[model samples]
Target chain A: MKDETDIQTPDEALEMAKKSRAAAADAGKKPLVYHLALPAIVGCLIASFALRDGLQLAVTAATMALLALVLWRVRKRGVWVGNLRGAVSYLLASLLIVLTLAAMFAIFWLKRTYGLDWPAAAIGAALFPVMVAMSLVWEKLRHRDLTGKMS
Target chain B: MTNPANGLEPLFNAPTRLQITAFLSGVAEAEFAVLRDMAGVSDSVLSKQLSALSDVGLVELRKSKLDGRQRTWAALTRKGRKSFAAHVAALQQLVQMAARAAE
Candidate 1:
């Protein structure tokens, strides 16, 4: 029996990882489903109504679909498999959030600067999904850290 | 240090397991191949260590068939991650204590 502190070779490491995966599979008893999907669908529907418009509808739908895709992929392919890709994807998503905020902030600043009042609906349509998506991703990541689940 | 959950030494307390956990703890999840490469141990040896950690509920394992072959992945449980953090804290303390004694 290998005691604790035993040095492992490359092959051993792979075997250990294999065993770890098997152990996790054996332990997990819950029927896997989209844990956040129903709530997300509901939230998206509410936002669609609030920010109803062609462009708003399109953008919001796309963003929600993208989020759903990510969650689905993460579920199908274990978090370990997409670890590097996931980091990159999250980084890109965060950048999108930053862009959304900057754009909204700019709109408000321009309105104040030029004595123009742009419609909140227009801004809301564009900004709402960005903020929602960002918060959703952040919440997922935080939950993973808190619960050790692969979001 | 002893594990409060099971009255055993923490997984990361063992140098080899510590090194393995240290490597896996940072990344989201690690494949058996990646861990094997990083730990620099034989397959059988690594399997034994992982078994010990799994038995203690500090780590988790999942295996699936990919391309009609088996692929294995490992992740730290919440308890395991917390324990790793605690072990690190303990190690830092030990180091500080040793430094003070040397001084």
Candidate 2:
């Protein structure tokens, strides 16, 4: 609407750029619930693996339903990041997936080999904090990237 | 004439537009109200700038119903993202150049 050719000196341009970066970082910030949602889902799924055949299915179904609800609420929040972008983001996400799968497998192994009663629940509990830490790290890295602090 | 070699985009010369694009760059889509608040501009001002950006195919707007009320959302087009990234790179370059010149 205003004049398109509004020019700035180098210093002003730099400052404006910095301000823009700050705005982007702010826009990207999410609530604590967003950070906690996925880990909670994963923790439930891991805990589900320890259940009896019928209960495992039920728990798995419930976990998926919860995931759907979380996604719906996120959409209703009016701002969506969709997925983190860039190679580093992809790498971290992939690492998280691998870690989750490994945890589940470890639970299975412990249950079969040692007939442990607490393997699934214990590992699932451990994963909640680990996943939360990873989530926080991912957010920190994403913020750094958004703010142009990475380079 | 603005020199193309400087890598400063004419479209982003306006600070409001630059700020809007920067915010859009971070999110996939944002509600109109959220963007308005972030930009700290009047609805008319933001609408005008968004319209300008839409005209140039830099951004897209969508309307949807939420809680039985109409809402608008905005996001950068692929072109917009590429352009914004280039503009940021150019700005960084300018800063670097200034530092080198000072040295």
Candidate 3:
């Protein structure tokens, strides 16, 4: 379509700007929405299992709360990390998934090798920190072009 | 009290275009994919609007390699930054006055 920026008068232009900006801002609000809910549910669920069946309910709740806070804090500051359309992003995502799976496997391995018999919840609790760390590192490395300090 | 809208650039007149400009205003520059998601437009739609924005010199679109990957990035020009600031101030004033009236 042709440029629609050539509307007749200032009033018309301003009105259009307001409407367009509102819509765009709404679309960009994705980070805030999922950052609020998903992190809490995922964090707590993972922590609950990682803590094994042995963690007190209060400790589990606290761990979940802590993980949720950490996840929210690590949210991409401006651009959406997931919107990246490069091979690098795909690599970062793959690395993150692999690391997470690896963390889970490590828990199983430790139980098998050392005869630890770690509970599922304890394993999940063990993986939480590693996952959170990987997420932050991956996001930073994922959009280094956007987030990296200007040279 | 100078006509705030007087400072409004005609280049940002289109709402979707305006939205794109607004998103670019906050950052140094952003990738096409990132901006497309922020603008909430289909790929072709955003490319068109971005070209329009570029034509008016309100935005700069650059294609380059980052971390061994090719990407298109957009940044608001100096003119765009000034124009958008004025527009936002005007909007804030309007909102404030409206709040007073409702109260």
**Model 3 - which docking category?**
incorrect
Q: Score the docking of each candidate (DockQ).
A: 0.12, 0.45, 0.09
lDDT of 3 by residue, A1-151 (tens): 3344445444454454554444333333444334444434454554454444556476667756767664444333333323442477577668757856775576567667876644545655555555555455544443443333211
Task: Give TM-scores of chain A for all candidates.
Answer: 0.32, 0.78, 0.41
Tens-digit lDDT track of model 1 for A84-123:
2247457856686576566556655755687444433355
lDDT of 1 at A11: 34
Clashing pairs in model 3, backbone N/Cα/C closer than 3 A: A49-A121, A50-A121, A50-A122, A50-A124, A50-A125, A51-A121, A51-A122, A52-A121, A52-A122
Score each candidate by Cα lDDT.
Answer: 0.55, 0.79, 0.58
The prediction achieving the highest DockQ against the true structure is 2
Ranking by DockQ: 2, 1, 3
Chain B TM-score in candidate 2, rounded to 2 decimals? Answer: 0.91
| lDDT string, candidate 3, B1-103, tens digits | 6665565565565666776876675455667877677656788989998998788787888886654667787878887777787766665555555667789
Ranking by TM-score: 2, 1, 3
TM-score against native, each model: 0.46, 0.79, 0.41
Off by over 4 Å in 3: A1-151, B67-69, B96-103
Distance (Å) between predicted and true CA of B102, model 3?
A: 6.4
lDDT of 2 by residue, B33-99 (tens): 8878876788988899899888999999999887788988999999998888777777777767778
